[model samples]
Target: MIQKIPPGPVTMSDWNFVIVEYQGHVVEKFLGYYYELQHIRFSSQVIEYDPQSNTGKTWSGSKYFFLDRPGPLYPLAQIYLAHFSRNEGIRVRLKYQG
Candidate 1:
């Protein structure tokens, strides 16, 4: 599933398995569908920019949190792992037809 990212908040609905890392270290790995996941969210939020500091670090309270409020982002190359058995390529099933 590949698509152009829009210039707005992007929300992921049905997804599982999210790996969070920090400074090349694995912080946490979420393993479960969207409905089963807890606490954290998977929506894109805006970063507040400050002209004086010449940096953006602020976040919206609605979808963003820090420390106890939420978390941060980083740069890394994502690698997906799939089961390679006699079944062949990655198996996918659609729940919606529309």
Candidate 2:
């Protein structure tokens, strides 16, 4: 389900939520905060998307793991909208690799 964010100022840490189905089943979820830094570099090749921008932007030198599951589809993405502030919002992007 896709949801639009309301207008207001919100903190980064307060923008996490869970995904539920019609029968109240939790498909997947995440907990984290977004930050705006002058510069950030990672040690691994794969890093998650920046919540602020909805683009497929990636940082170099980052280390992260891809969570996956066994299914007919090899990979799938679950996207969530996280509002950090009324003017600034982020999309919590999740990719299922297993």
Q: In candidate 2, what are the lDDT values of residues 1-98, reduced to their tens digit?
A: 32333322222222222232334432333222323321211111223444344212223322222232212121112112323212223222323322
- Per-prediction TM-score to the true structure, in the order listed: 0.21, 0.18
Local error of candidate 1 at residue 98 (angstroms): 25
Clashing pairs in 1: 65-69, 65-70, 66-69, 66-70
Tens digit per residue, CA lDDT, model 1, 1-70: 3233233322222233233333554322211112222322332323452335322221333221122111
Candidate 1 wrong stretches, greater than 4 Å:
20-23, 27-98
- Point out where model 2 deviates above 4 Å: 1-57, 69-81, 88-98
Which stretch of 10 consecutive residues in model 1 shows the poorest summed lDDT?
69-78
Q: Find the 10 residues in a row with the least total lDDT in model 2.
A: 37-46
